[model samples]
Target: MNRDLLGRHRSVLPDWLALYYDEPLEITHGEGRYVWDSEGNRYLDFFGGILTTLTAHALPEVTKAVGEQAGRIVHSSTLYLNRPMVELAERIAQLSGIPDARVFFTTSGTEANDTALLLATTYRRSNTVLAMRNSYHGRSFSSVGITGNRGWSPTSLSPLQTLYVHGGVRSRGPYAQLGDAEFVAACVEDLEDLLGHTRPPAALIAEPVQGVGGFTSPPDGLYAAFREVLDAHGILWISDEVQTGWGRTGDHFWGWQAHGRNGPPDMLTFAKGIGNGMSVGGVVARAEIMNCLNANSLSTFGGTQITMAAGLANLTHLLEHDLQGNARRVGGMLIERLRSAAAQVPQVREVRGRGLMIGIELTEPGTDEADPRAVSAVLEAARDAGLLIGKGGGHNTSALRIAPPLSLTVAEAEEGAAILERALRSLP
Candidate 1:
């Protein structure tokens, strides 16, 4: 059954779309932290469908909300008043940390980022954008142009002239050996130097934790320091929280808070988990920036009643249950468990991340060289052992991504960690 489905998928889907494992399993259904494949095997879903499943699969509240909203109205477009959309927007705006925030919804993170680009360029009246050295915003033409990760970037042509910045990866850069304070200072100097040689950029966009770049993060307060420099030049700071938002990081509700000393970003883009499997993405910005799109704009399917309903239900459940606290407590334990396991394996170069967003970078036994093949082998072995994880990195996808749903339990964490340990041990 899996083979036949794979053949059909390959024939219909675009070739650029990648799949996991040598023999990919078809996930038919899921409940809580587990999913069942077409072959009647169950696996702990640690990657949470690329971190799109923020809460859990088949969450009763979100499921009921989606069903009821669909029964009433699937979509009415942005042409009409959307109460559910308005409510969701209000909630997000208040939580955004940006005063007088305005929310515009989209169907995916790509669109959310594209919207941000349009706002920044038009508002600042400049096309020059600053991006991190190994950052990925989205796949759209504008978003992809600012994305610095070569593995994910498909084309060089772009409407925006993007300048790459430093300080995204803390462990593998020229300034890697520096202490946190010195590292931040060095990166700031680099940014100043880059600015000296280029035109005034409209905005600097970055991810707090680079998801596709193997969950790498700069030292805390790095963005805050950059914010000081950007503010002096009146450049916008757009935080791409596509993979780091909705309290997955454990320590904060938003990943940008790690650098919040200089205040929230000018604009923030988000997606991947808020809708709890429904299609929901959006940007939150101060009124001055969000309203810069002069003429008129609307995403036809953005904030459809169905998706808004799901987002509202999911958000309510997340907050009411204090899942952020759950993420903090559970994620702390899980990371320590993985760290202990990774310490025993020489191929495991590093284990990093906050909250539930963890990454295990693989390298050759006695060397710093990344081992992408070893990453693939462990991923395959983990699947065979009834666990589902993910792979990502700028170094040829050499890191294992382990972002489970926010509702992960202690027992489930232990189970997944043991499976992962066995898989890692199998590597050379």
Candidate 2:
């Protein structure tokens, strides 16, 4: 049955759309941190549908809200006044940390980022933009142009002239050998040098934690240092929080808070996890930047009633349950356990991340060369052991990504970690 479905999927779907495993498994249903396949095999879900399932699978609160909203009205477009949309916008505006903020909703992180780029370019009147190395923004044309990870970037043609910046990945690069302070200085110096040779850019967009870049991040103060330089040149800072927002980072509510000594960014794009698997994304910016354009703009399905309702319920549940606190407590234990497991495996290059978003980079034993084969082997082994995980990296997709739902229990973490340890050990 799964084979037939896979055949049909390949026949119709784009070839670029990839699937996991040597033989793909069909997921039938899920609840809490576990999912069942079509054959009724149960598996612990660690990737959380690429971290979109923010709270949990089949969360009662979100499902109830979605059903209630659907019963009333599914969508009326942005042409009409939507109370749920307005309420969600207001809540997000207050939480965005920007003064006099305004929100524009989109259907995905790609659209959110595309809107942000449009605003930055039009407001600054410059087409040139700065992006970080080893970063993955989105799949749209404009977003793709800014993405520095070669594995994800499909084309060179772009609407904006994007210049790649340094410092997103702390472990690998020209400045990798330097100390934290020195690395920041070097990256800053490189930025200043780049600015001198190129046209003035509209903004410097970055991910607080490079999600598709093996969950790598620079020193805590790197962005703060870069902010000083950008301010001098009137370059706006846009934080892409699609993967790291809503307290996924444990120490802070937003990932940008780690480098927010000066203040919040000029704009931020968010999606994934906000609606607990529903399609909801948006851009939040200060009044001046957000309202720069004189022309009107609206997303037909951006702030539809159903999605807004789901977002509201999910956000409320997250805050009320203090899931961020839960993530910190549970994620801390999970990472330590995984680290101990990885210590025995020489192919485990590095284990890093904060909160529920962790990455275990794999390389050839006693060498720096990336071992994607080992990653593939571990992935298959984990699946056979009744655990679902994800893989990503800048270098040939050689990192294991473990991001369970924020509401993960201590027992679930222990179970998943044990399965993962056995999978790693089983690797050849």
Candidate 1, residue 404: lDDT: 97
Residue by residue across 159-204, what tens digits does model 2's lDDT show? 9999999999998989999999999999999999999999789999
lDDT per residue (tens digit) for residues 16-69 in model 1:
998888898888999999999988999999999899999999999999999999
Task: Kindly report which residue stretches of model 2 are placed more than 4 angstroms away from their true locations once superposed.
Answer: none
Question: How close to the true structure is residue 193 of candidate 1, measured as C-alpha lDDT?
Answer: 91
Q: On a 0 to 1 TM-score scale, where does candidate 1 land against the true structure?
A: 0.99
Clashing pairs in 1: none
Task: Provide TM-scores for the models.
Answer: 0.99, 0.99
lDDT of 2 at 391: 92
Number of clashing residue pairs, candidate 1? 0
